[model samples]
Target: MSPPHAVIAGAGIGGLCSALCLARAGWRVSLYEKAKILEESGAGLQLSPNACAVLRKLGVLERLTPFALAPQAIRIRRARDGATLALMPLNDAEARWGAPYLVVHRADLQRALLDAVAHEGRISLQTDAAVTGFAYGSDGVAVAISRGASRLEATGDCLIGADGLRSFVRQKLSPDDLNFSGRTAWRAVVEADRVPAAMRSEETTLWLGRKAHLVHYPLRQGTIINVVAIVDEDFQPDTDNFWSSHGASKFLEARFSRWDKSARDLLSAAPEWRKWPLADRAPAARLVSGRVALLGDAAHPMLPFLAQGAAQAIEDAGVLAEVLARGQDVEASFRAYQEIRLPRVTRVQKESRRQAVIYHLGGPAAFLRDAAMRALGGETMLARYDWLYRVRESPGQK
Candidate 1:
């Protein structure tokens, strides 16, 4: 008879995309975000063809193109000599996957998704509402949230946790299972005009050295460059829990002092920088618990080496929405969602860890690794990722 109502926690990319997909499937959706104002906070995010396809299906791809860049190639170079170790071409990537690879500001993508959600009549967004507790029973699920001094409650057939790494919903499920990856990532955006003309390029460049790596790409129609430098360190700063904590330029420069000129130049060009301590959790044996389901980073948090953090989250939203639209038993649909997604996300998590080791090889080991990568060539890398980039969930099925 009536469409089921869904309550989504967090308005990040995953949550917003989930809301969009559920609303399109004729489900009434309400999204709660703790932030009073929705603004862009992070640096750049690279969307593979899989993520791009989902956005295209959601009708926001065209709107995002102006603020995004589709690089023709990705080059991995040695930090000492800038010698290319491997090159993956993206010239015909769109022809193969039906969508091109894209890089965009985290804020711009969020804005585009939010705008699309605004047009959906079945979806209502409530900002400044922080979900405090939830209860699942035979009748339904009831969520308690707070905004300032006021408390609000909502009941729905299902509750999805699309919140980020520090998800409140996750705390309820597996409170003591969180694990840290022992790596810290520093990110910043520098204006193209401020960078030296010789340093700017249309390609995505990565410089790998011992225990650290730097990735740089163009964003905002090539007007700004996004740089992410990750280092393996034993300690993290004791400060606020925010991901966008300001970082010191001197500390970063010292970390990369032995790197090549290209990385040095890029690091010097950074106008603003923030630090993010990469963290993850062992795969939850189950993503759904009765009337509640976990989505995005809350369900599966992976390292950024593979650049699939957001991409996987977007995939989760699509698959979950498709299963829920079947009108089958909610528990059965959610169980199917976890079964279909767990294996893939687990593989990604493991691969990302392997890449971290590969990118940080040192001395003779680094040279040997580079030689092996060159022998395999660019086509091999692209071929290796086809399974990840080509996946699509069939609607109305697990």
Candidate 2:
């Protein structure tokens, strides 16, 4: 009997990782990317040990190491005075989680995934092919794709939408329920050499202030530093129209000007900046519909406070591949995928929302929050995150 064929939409991290996993599991996988050319254009991303372990299992970790930085700690501070509130040690991350935490340029990670997908002979990646629509039935799932004036259709035993938050496949599945999270995020990368020597450190630093917070970490072996500033605001300009959009540095500086000198210096050095209006959907009543299923941001889009957006998506790929490769019934495998992923992703989503509030507290509330952090101590704060960093795919499952 022939291995089942899988069709994947959107060739971002999730989609490409899905293709890598499925193809390695002996399934014939085809990935469609709407962009004319494959280019990794994001600022940077942090991959906790949990994410690293999954990628290691998929044989892409070693190739990505050159582009990654393994920070020794994560420090949260008061934005007004740069006083440390909580410091979580990450030096022993690999020993605890079975893989090292990684900070890499977003483009570098994408390149690694794309490279692995290309090397997997069972995977067919079609760039410039945009998935226009999909139809599912008991027999199978069929997808319509377009590239300029030409259009094509393909059929597979199952379909996975890893198309991200604005997924067309998701629109087909649940059109009316998408909800915005009432937040906006600004991101930029500054060369580490440009930052003052005293400010350059091998640690992830976070500054929590009223109505906004900033996170910074070294990527590319300290050659560059990635900064993400998130603010809770009344109005967020719609950035959903374009996948990559540039934002004004002056605007970002004005918003964060009152922050500590270190943060202001870092922001001032940023050469490019982009804005993303954060949004999400409630956990779907069901992530699977007939032969069609959703994965990654399409299935769950969460706030980045927890930094689990990509990690959860990577986890979804690993679990889904294992279930399908075991030769289980297709419907059962789809059901298992949803069952295993929904609860965890939902919890992460809610926790991320909660963190947003804690990070943006003001005056008396902010003092209380910091006092609690000090009382808990850095070790305790690190302990609180064990549940997040320790999750891994069951070894005996496959």
Each model's lDDT: 0.85, 0.85
For model 1, residues 48-118, the per-residue Cα lDDT tens digits are 99888888889988889988889888888888878888898987878877688988889889989988998
RMSD of each: 1.8, 1.9
Off by over 4 Å in 1: 237-242, 393-398
Candidate 1 has which clashing residue pairs, if any?
none
C-alpha positional error of residue 85 in candidate 1 after TM-score superposition, expressed in Å? 1.2
| Deviation in Å, model 2, residue 212 alpha carbon | 0.6
Full-model lDDT, candidate 2 = 0.85
Alpha carbon deviation, residue 147, candidate 2 (Å): 1.9
- Poorest stretch of ten by lDDT in candidate 2: 235-244
lDDT of 2 by residue, 1-398 (tens): 87789999989888988899899889999899999887765677889887888899888998899888888899989999899998889999988767898888888898889788878999999999999988888778889999889999999999999998888888888884556567778888888889998667999998999999999998877888888888876664555563346878888778888888988999999888887777766767778887788889898888899998999889888888988888877788888888777777788888987887888899999989999999998898988878888846582332
Candidate 2: C-alpha RMSD after superposition: 1.9
